[model samples]
Target: MNAHPDTPPASLPLFLHDSVADAVALSAVDSLAPLLGIAVKEAEKVVLKANECAAGFTVREILCTNETREILRELVKLLASYAVTKTGMATCMTRTPTLDPDALRKRFDDVREGMRLHELLDGEQIAAVQELFAKAEIAPIRFDTTPVIATRRRGLESKLQERYGDYVRVAVVDSAATAQALLREAYPVLLVADADEIVLDEPGIISIPEHAVADDSIVYPEFVVQSFRAKSAAIAAFVQLVTEFDERKTSSLLDKISIPDLEAVLALLAELARDESAHKVNLADTVLSWEEAINQEARFIAQTGGGADDFKAYLDEAVISMADELQLAGEDRDLLLESAYENLERGPPFEFSRAHTIRLQEHYARRIAEQRYFRLRDYATRLIPYEEAVNTALKRLFYLDFLFAVARFSHEFGLTIPEISSDGLGVIKGRNLFLVDEELKGGETVVPISYSVGSTDLGIFGATPLPVAILTGANSGGKTCLLITLATSMILTELGLPVPAERAEIPLLPLYLYRRKMIKKTGSFEYSMRALSRIFMREGPKVVLIDELEALTEPGAMGRIMAALLNHLPASTRAVMITHLIHELRPHIDLKKIRVDGIESEGLDATGNFIVDRQPLFNHIGSSTPELVITKLMSRVRKAKLRAVYREILQALEKERDAWP
Candidate 1:
């Protein structure tokens, strides 16, 4: 196959090279799979392979770059389509069992032996005979000797003799005498029948009489007559069997069996008859030996300048001497003579102008080229171990396709590869990466929150990086989103992929996301806490994400319980905990060991919407009071009693106004 002129060929590196040192699992991949638009099984494989840090990072960078990404995208789609086409072709691949070369040679030898009576003929005549024999289905004879068949054969012979011959004869002449008689004929001898003719009405046989010619020499006619004496002899031997079997009824009965079974049975019978039968012409053998045909054609091409007109003309004339030497007599010799003459008069034409000859040469040249091409094609198919190669190619293609998918994902999420950090993770202006489909959120701008662990922003918390942080904020004020952003960024970076942030520093740690499992059965909270304890104790510098501390137990007790859990966890662990009960847990956690962050709602807007600042307030002490909730709810309280209760809530807010700051 030729390469497309427009395409610049490139060989892409394998996505997962064996040289990679580290391979880690990213827990976030389950959530991230849909973002990449891949199945879970595929996503898992890609993520695991990509976690082989070095190569993953290199491949990811290569694919994620703007120019390379676009090129790979088109390449992937093209390869995918080609792979599908190959798959379809494989499904449609069918083969007919082939004969061995030796078997094919034997078949040709047999055919030649059967047609040997015609050896006296020219090359053109011999070639024609060979071609006709190739077409004949000469399986062993199973003569259907029903009355109907016999009658039909008789009628056919009668019509052939009547139409072609002007005279008829029924002679029991010997071979030499028969030849002598033919030498005496003036008019052409059309057909001759011996014992076979007797069965199909011997009276209808056709022949011509002897006549005198010039110079006391005999001139033989082109036409000859033949008898089916061999076939007649076989029929006579099987006369009892032929009489007993009714062809019509047997055929109808065989048709009642399933087609496949009937065919199998008939094939077995044919094979049996071929082994037993003596009459060769009655055989129904239609199997074309490809090897025989190819070898024969090759030999012919090597002769006579591959069928030049002069060579054909010479063969047509030269074959007469061969005919005169043949010992075959009577009907057999006549039949061969008839076929030879027929072939000489009209067979494959060789005469042509120089230009036409050149054209023919070019055509055969192209054909030879194509024949070699197919031969190589078939040889390669048989010789090469393709299963392994196909699998390897498919893996490469899949990797390319996946890389493109990630490119598109990164483009949509506005992602970039983050600077790797050994200590822990850090991010600046990081968006909520889990909210992959922004439009689904009804046009709400995804709040980009900036916070860090194992590193601190200089402006707010100074340069000292903390390994643990407590995120406390107003309900629905985006603390969970912020925590998710940090964790997701780290996960993506760890996977050697891009993070959805302006700037990020990530640690290569096994990440664990600790969230309350919502089990319908009772005592699930205790079970979850115990699991959390076991997870927290695992060796770190690992990062852990905790959401909604209240889900662990009763809200009033959760603050103390969470505070205890945080304090007991390994100091080497980096943790982010999102909780609403910040004030309750504050006194229990050692300030020197953890950083405190919060999402603050400055106040409500004129429309009663809280003007919540989505940014993380680093190193801050802030509480989300019920004041805004009560204020927003005041309008919805319609009953007079509820209004009075709302007034009391307002009066209490007034009393606490001095301590609001």
Candidate 2:
């Protein structure tokens, strides 16, 4: 049950306190699951749970990051050697039946009762009378001598014939010499006679002892009871093993994982390997083959109406097919065919024998039953002792699959464990993972941007970083992408997962919220205000990312609202607000409390794309640079008058740019 024994300790932070944070965290996981080669639902459940437990992590837990890394490394190495598939792991999951000890004991008792000789007696009396003897003297009949002794002997023979007639032959011989002759012929014979008259030294001959005859308490051999118990337990355990153990291969990068959890998985894997190597018996295959044979016979009977002729033909085909399936030949094939024919001749389903077809069906049923009882008995004898261990190991194998998936994700993405910061958040060379592939497809690499908020020093920002900042930039200057990158890094690090950054120092904040830019619509402004107001009300060390709040109202009023909101935010919060109304808002905000950062466009390149620096500049404001965009359009225009009009507008924009900042 303690599958995650080495999970993060109490000092680690979680970001799922509110629905917003959960949305952000889940979105991050959903985007990461495919990259990690795991199912989305599985990743969400495991990653979120781990993050929740990681809150309030102790110093020891923080130090264990290295151990987590080492475990992931080991998993990666193992996966490199073994190309395990989900289908293969599914095959390893065997279904074992629940073998209740009491039920098994009852079954054994029932079989034992059936094997008892007293069950056949039912208070019958033997009346012995004078009878002719061969090579023996008929002395004074001492034991219930009467003429009815022959009749009593015939009744006993009938009962024995009813019980084991198919598997054995019962003969009532007048003398021991006749029993010895039958034994010499190698016939399986159970001899029934008066104790005084029955005496044989043959190995194969079965006879009741004098004591058993006097007590009327003979029973089947002890091995039968023992075999029955073994088979019951083994079949149940085997069925469970087949059905439940569904661990898949793990070979990718994962978030932070506990060392104890990893070691536990390794131990279970070792135990399973050892058990498999030691037994060397293919019990599953044997069981399946017998089941297939029975199923094929049943279908044939159902289709052919179970005629004697049809059964003989089916048996002929079954022998060859079953022999190939079981890889048996010669005597083994002959023995199987002989057993089937013998069961057919045994007559009647013991419970329902009115129909000939029903009796034929019972033959196939009994043959398969016999096969399972013997084979499972042998397997169960060896497996019973390790039942508990095997079950536990299988359950642990499932945990192993989760770990492997996480490891493989981490490995493939080249994610590194981020340091847990007590103060601000900082990422050195952070790239937005969500855009990495798309950017690459466009023949351009993702520009890794480094930025910091709060007091964390990244050596690029010269001055001390403020806890609150207003982000401004030209259109398509990567301001929104930067916010997303920072948010992604924070959420991932908080969840104990590696981030898409070269180096990151993330605060262990219990709350994280990222609100994407909302388009201006009726009631949307009210909704946005309500959502943003909750951020100020919350009291904790947290991180908040908001984009384009100015779109909600007029520039002047929105600027005042932005200043008031930023000023009212708790000092414990680190926040970044992306907006184009900085010029209208800067007059109302306290310069000492808030910093301004910008992503500036450096005009157009030869391809007519904006040459922009994606990294934000600390303590600077950026222009929207509409004039440069207009200038690019002017070059593509053919009308002389339109071009002249653009030139005049550009001249006016130049004057405004020069006077604005």
Candidate 3:
């Protein structure tokens, strides 16, 4: 069940801050100890795929990006506490190379020349991979360190080039690459301080002189160090956004600040926070407060007293109004308001008012988010100056002939870094939180083409959008790869990494991979089925990707099992499935089909086998007005086909339903 080590994957490293976030993450894992024990009772080959990458950074490095290290340590400790019969750790990383001195000057010049107006590419590739060792934490996994080292060095080359090389050439020629070079070294270190690993190495893979390799041919145009054109443009856009903000223009979205609403909300919160418990249990006091509350609409709290509904009703309306002020319209906005209301009803400590609770929670969540956001924003901001620096790095990389190699450096991790979001990634990976993609590498095919195979969207609108997708697609039709790509892509996206695609937007991560093969030893059809079932049934608030959902057994039985899965799947994850039971579970399948087109019956000839005369079809399902109602550009392409494809698809689905298993 091991995947090819060299598969290409673009992943965002997990941040395992060495503090509070880590404590929370570890505590969450500790919560699963009992559950994990139940799973390992009969299973074997226990694999704990943790955020080992974070562990890769030397402890000396300032660890504390969302408290990763302590969380990782706690996870390992908990796993050890589990007393699993057997277990191991594994990770996949892209190989990165490094360079130096005399090698430096040549790389500098090449990157400079390529950035000239027309040429843009990854700098000359002087690729090398190092031993990215994942030291034994309590002992399970080992990460690939060499690749990280290589990439890190490659990143730093620009800075080295600029400080010792030429700034004029860096600025005038290929600016993007020049910018990239300056940041490369620093980025890896950011990982060291922020993440669980350093898959990209420092001075490991850098742009050198194209002369070192050959001509501009060796490096890609995008990697050209002198490509300053785009950076200048981005600066303009940044300036525009700032100017608009300063000018109080609508485009600036400054209205979002809502000072008036904020004040109203704070006042409401203060009024609600009143210690109504001290007010009274006496009928006269109740009457007085009730009368006052009705007129003034003040929030009253009684720890075990009365008036729950009265307060809930009024607070609900207030929260709704606050949401409206924030411009949260439609369902999403409504849902947010409802959530705020529900949170209020649950009430905070007796000291805080329902309004105050909601306000504080809102503020705190925003604070936490803002804190996280600022960290990333800071990183991005620092990156701008480097865009200024790529020019020089490109020249160095070109001279060293490592351009193209450098551009793809960010994604060099041979293994797709699973963007595991909810809970620490270790839980999903070890506890069999169902996952689809592992060896999947549709790469280019999956992206630009938007080909999804056996893909199922498990999002529930009233609930969690994207439910578990139970996929069904023909073999060799890119079914497996599609599932893998989606599973990993979603994980990556959720984790906040730009996945390998034309463009991808998804949830965050601590991606876990569960191979169907691992559960095989559980033996019986029902036993393995239940074992797989157990994986999803464990603690949730996590996404599940199940491949060959039916391969566990009989079609009729599988249909029933799948039906149960569709119905019982955790409301947390948006699951997608890949199965051949498309026809069997057509009734249960609430997903669209992404199939290969060009199946000309004429082309089938004697074999009746499809001979692809054209590209694959990217067809989504459950998309009529309801689908249309839910869209905002994400489903643009799918929505466009709705006018024509909608009814036909509906009719086909109706017909297919009649023949379901």
TM-score of each: 0.43, 0.47, 0.29
**What's model 2's lDDT at 20?**
19
| The candidate that achieves the highest TM-score relative to the unseen native structure | 2
- Give the Å error, residue 171, model 2: 41
- Pick out the ten consecutive residues of candidate 1 with the lowest summed lDDT: 221-230
Q: List, residue by residue over 1-661, the lDDT tens digit for candidate 1.
A: 0122122112211211111110112112332233334564454444434432312233323222222223233333322232222211111111011112333233223323322323333566445433332232111212111000011124344443332222222233435445335423311222333334432212212232122111011111111100111122222212222233343133211123232332333333344345334322110121123223333543576574665355445544433433343322344334433443443444444212233334333333333333333332333233223223222322222222233334445556677667666666777678875464453345677877667777533233442477788887677788767766776665455334567788787665555565433322334777666656655555545567777758656776888988887787675777888877766787688777778776777777888788888887777644465766876778667888988898898777545432322
lDDT of each: 0.43, 0.49, 0.32
- Model 1, position 629, has a per-residue lDDT of 81
- Model 2, 345-458: lDDT tens digits are 654331111243233333333333333333433343444344334333322333233233334444444555666666788889888766763554574688898888887856
**Candidate 3, which ten residues in sequence have the lowest lDDT sum?**
128-137
Question: Candidate 1, residue 410: CA error in Å?
Answer: 2.1
Mark the regions of model 3 whose C-alpha exceeds 4 Å error after superposition: 1-406, 410-448, 451-468, 491-498, 509-523, 586-609, 612-661
Ranking according to lDDT, highest score first: 2, 1, 3
Alpha carbon lDDT at 198, candidate 2: 33
Backbone clash numbers for all candidates listed:
12, 40, 150
Better of 2 and 3 by lDDT: 2
Error of 1 at 58 (Å): 20
Indicate the residue-level lDDT of 111 in model 1. 27
Q: By how many angstroms RMSD does model 1 differ from the true structure?
A: 29.7
List ranges where model 1 is wrong by over 4 Å. Answer: 1-378, 381-400, 440-442, 456-464, 516-523, 623-625, 634-661
